[model samples]
Target chain A: MSSITSAKANVLVVGSGGVGTMAAFALEKGGKASVTAVLRSNFAAVQQSGFDIKSLDHGDIQAWRPSAIRNSVPNTATDATAQPYDFIVVTTKNIADIAPSVAEIIAPAVSPGHTAIALVQNGLNIERPLIAAFPSNPIISGVSFIGATEEKPGTIRHDDHDVLLVGAFANPNIAPQASAAAAKIFSDMYGSCPGIDVIYEPDVRFTRWRKLLYNASFNSVATILRMDTSRMRISEHVIDDLIRPVMLEIRATAAAAGVELPMELVDRMITVDTFEAFFKPSMCQDIEKGNYIEFENIVGEPLREAERLGVHTPALKVIYGLLKGLQWQRMEAKGLVKIPLVSEPGMKYGSKPRVVT
Target chain B: MSSITSAKANVLVVGSGGVGTMAAFALEKGGKASVTAVLRSNFAAVQQSGFDIKSLDHGDIQAWRPSAIRNSVPNTATDATAQPYDFIVVTTKNIADIAPSVAEIIAPAVSPGHTAIALVQNGLNIERPLIAAFPSNPIISGVSFIGATEEKPGTIRHDDHDVLLVGAFANPNIAPQASAAAAKIFSDMYGSCPGIDVIYEPDVRFTRWRKLLYNASFNSVATILRMDTSRMRISEHVIDDLIRPVMLEIRATAAAAGVELPMELVDRMITVDTFEAFFKPSMCQDIEKGNYIEFENIVGEPLREAERLGVHTPALKVIYGLLKGLQWQRMEAKGLVKIPLVSEPGMKYGSKPRVVT
Candidate 1:
């Protein structure tokens, strides 16, 4: 164990948002890993001045840089001298439709039989693409519950909670016992620090569904309604009529997917997790900032699973539709896609009036 | 029949919106009724200059007014010598939570046993209040489909369609045969003009549900999404996933209420009625203008019926909850209702950090 702790593993964190930065901070502070973060938009500023983090757990952290920083991932063909990464942790928003998918983004550093791909992300059925892309690699899946936001580039404001459930996704190419061993190694290194709470989950799918009970209902509903947690909870009959029904639909869908989330989880999410006044969910914040939402990974993929399992989810269907509409509107505004105008009828009415009242 | 046509009925039209003004215009144009219009906000402008009417059916008219105009509805106690109206046509917006209810607005002109109350409104179970108030009076309920808008104080723009389904509500106090006769009399007078296609529906509850199949689904969905008909329809999977599911819920609810609206009506409403480009539904318009929406009559009352009948309507319930949230937001913005701010927890986290990474 001391020899294992003595040799620091190289971990690469892709998509350095609030979650990514915090994970990097925790991993490096653990002293069990040498962390390199790829900062796309804030590469220059962060390299120049480092991060200024005001966190509930870490208190005030000023002008702190990770062990290493890279603007772009190294291409193996172009740079033959690039070192192999022990783990490539992805912390980006799980939007499946964007160009150069997350799997492709982390392809170069993903060393087969060596690099364990750890996904620190939100959503359901998110491990499929990575698993499909790198069949030989063991995928470390995580469901993180953290209150962290990048107020600006290299500026983070994290709230109190920071809990994560980690497990190995079942991979056809890799042995099941080997995958579990890989996940244990990754989680041990990740939780080596004082601030991060990482629990090893044998069945991460169950854990994923457990987290989705709150996310699929409150997050989506609050975003669509344009209300904060406080406002949504305080609104009359909103919980009983809308949010609770959505949660029940999710619970049913989870059951169909071979997971039984307790009905009590719904009550805990509504009453305990949403106890914060005016706390905006990430999706709500994304919408207000005119950023692209993760409808496909969070709601769409799960809805497809529900459909495959023959579960009826009318509430989820409507929520999915509305989110799609909103995201399309945003895309159109950003000139990402041009929606054609509907063909107008030549005349609004018949040639002659039926009656002249 | 000739005597009935020749007799000039005394008609008082309350709530002089586009629907009310057009009803008044049509009744007077028929040469069978002396129309007295009660105009609230536009009373001064309309009384001073009359209406500048540009209609698709009626063509253009410079200045037009009903036979008589009054600023306010007469109060029986205050105006003891007020004339008793033969029929009071209520065409106002059916907002149930307002101070002066639609039933009370025309209470003074409602002559028991003699005057018939014609509700040219859009909603379900709207006749209940009036039925409760004037038990002996005939309740002439109408489901109107007209494209008319009051652009300004004294300007009107009328589209081509002008169809109405007229029927009488079943009143316990009045004989059924007498109620039918009263509905016939009112319909004849109202549709006397050449442009109005008035269909007498013996089962008006069926018609109300039929109309609600569109209003409760498309209208409410469009408003919540902040998208017009074109935008909503053109979005991918919206009609199939969101709008159609809502219509199915309404259809099931209608079936539970003993009204078998055909499955084909959903197709008709989606394809034909929504053919027009950028057509904003009335509820969407009401939300844009910050007016109180008719959620209670259009979606709320029907949802209540579904609940009472033990029919599950998850889609409708969600739509109802959202509309309620939006309206409450609007009300709070207008300082109508003060929503108390939630008590903030003193501290966000526990005493000590579990881990500080």
Candidate 2:
């Protein structure tokens, strides 16, 4: 990966959505290399226009010119505007949500020994498809701890701290180097932004699974009930009655995944009593905007994963069924034009939803 | 009461809010009584023209005439511009949410032996203060099961099978009689006006608790997640992990109140979920309209009841805390001249929230 480090590096940050934009802006601000931000829509306007960069101490809707691209033409392979990149950061909001579109697009850009690619999204098994596609370039499976949203297209409004966990997909030796390189870039970029903490996680998959505990707890409860994160957090009924059992099931699955998380981590999830008091989750936001939620992937995929690993996920099964039904009904309402409604009610999954009653 | 009932009751359905106007129109069509439909401020225009009643079934916007109470004198004794009421249905939305002084405007009109005040709104408890004010007036507490929303300030867009649960303040004799009276009147009203199925609830308090289960299970979840009812009901995780436990907790508290619900009540709640695929709940509507919710009463009171009865409610508690915090934050943002641009991490309420840690 000398091309990305040794020579003058041209980084292309594709899918300039919420997370993508955050990463692109961070990389651009790093000033280590030139980063070209590519988006799918009229996002350049949002980028060019001053948007609020909110952090713990200082938050202002500032403007920055970060060499933006909105799905237009590539200048040329040899030209500065259209030249091939030394490194590519593929950050698509639910790009994997609709199959292998991101992999399909980014696979062409990977220059083998020249560039390295990183995925900053949720769920496990993200690296498999990309690694499968390239097999040559070092692919990093990363987990971003920051919460981000865009008011306009390019203007990313950062809410939470910017922390990251990165690890090599196949090659474990390159992970430390990858993590250090990425950290150096991000630290410079987001130094002014409050709480930018990064942890070089060697066991990226296990770390991803550990984080699943958080998502499974919040996502299932929040989605089914259509609540924001804070609401789910502050609720006693949610914490003790609802989240505990669901979390316990998640823990079981995590254990089955061969990942071991500390009890302290589990406890932290349990005691989050003040969340619903503020902040709306992405899933809830999606529902509010009448956009599609990643119910199947968020709950369904994990349960399937657990089942494959011989894990017990009774509570998750129930939640999965309910969420699936909710989504299916929407499809049915459009004159059965979309998806099937009421496949099953949760208890267990993959074997069909067996009605408890 | 007997005189008005015998001589075709003259009812003043005051407060022409969402529930009020619908009741006014319904009572007028019931044909069992003459209704003087009154709006708080817009009564003048309604008096000049008429009221619009929109129905989903016929896709028709029907008009109706009422002896308007705009700039009219208020004298229950005098039958000139006003008349003695048999039943005065107070359909103010979330009146319980407001301060006692604000919500207590109708205390003077609700005289015992002259008027019967029925609260046709969401939430379980209603008649405590009303009963204290007029013990002899048969302070009937009817929880309306109809799914209708006021399209305009004075217009009711009747959307569902017009169903209502009519009962009274837990008293054996007073409860069923009021329910029966209202039921018969509602049945005869406008040839059941697109099917007004008013059930004669023996104990409306029980019915309130019962209907509350649906609200807590569906409304709380749907509002927080910003999804329709079907979306919520479909997810297995939502159903098992989130909803069922909440329902069970609610059931425990209801049982503690010496109430025994049918085994299939939860199933029934899910069955009725088909109609609400795109259904935006009243709570979400209220939030969107920049109005405070009946959080303390609808969600909070139920939680309190559960606590008092020693029932465990984790999901509900989490949801409650989340909504409460959100409402508070929104309020703070609105009231504060210069608001904080930064926000807490969406992951703050992760499955296992950081607070619990």
Q: What C-alpha RMSD separates each model from the true structure?
A: 4.6, 9.0
Model 2 chain B worst lDDT window (10 residues)? B336-345
Chain A (candidate 2) TM-score to true chain A: 0.78
Pick the lDDT winner. 1
lDDT by residue (tens digit), candidate 2, A1-357: 544453335777776766766666666555565667765664546545733455432355466656646464243344554666666777665424444466777655666555667777666566667666665557766677666777665556676656776665664435456544543443343343344555555557677777777777776666555655554443344555556677777777777777777766767755443433455556666666665666665677788888898886766765665566555555455444332344344423212322421
Question: Per-residue lDDT for A1-357 in model 1, tens only?
Answer: 101223788788998988999999989988888988999988998999999999887789999899989999875446765567878889998778666788888988877677888998888878889888888888989888887888889999888567888899888887888788878988888888787788998889988887787788778877887887666666646677777888888899999888988777776667554343567788888899888888788788888988999999878877888888788888778888765554444522212222221
**Per-residue accuracy of model 2 over B56-170 as CA lDDT, tens digit each:** 5335555566645544325555445454566676666654544553126665454455576666667755666666666556655657655566665456676665566665564
Off by over 4 Å in 1: A1-6, A274-276, A344-357, B1-7, B97-100, B274-276, B308-312, B344-357
Task: Identify the leading candidate in terms of DockQ.
Answer: 1
CAPRI classification of candidate 1: acceptable
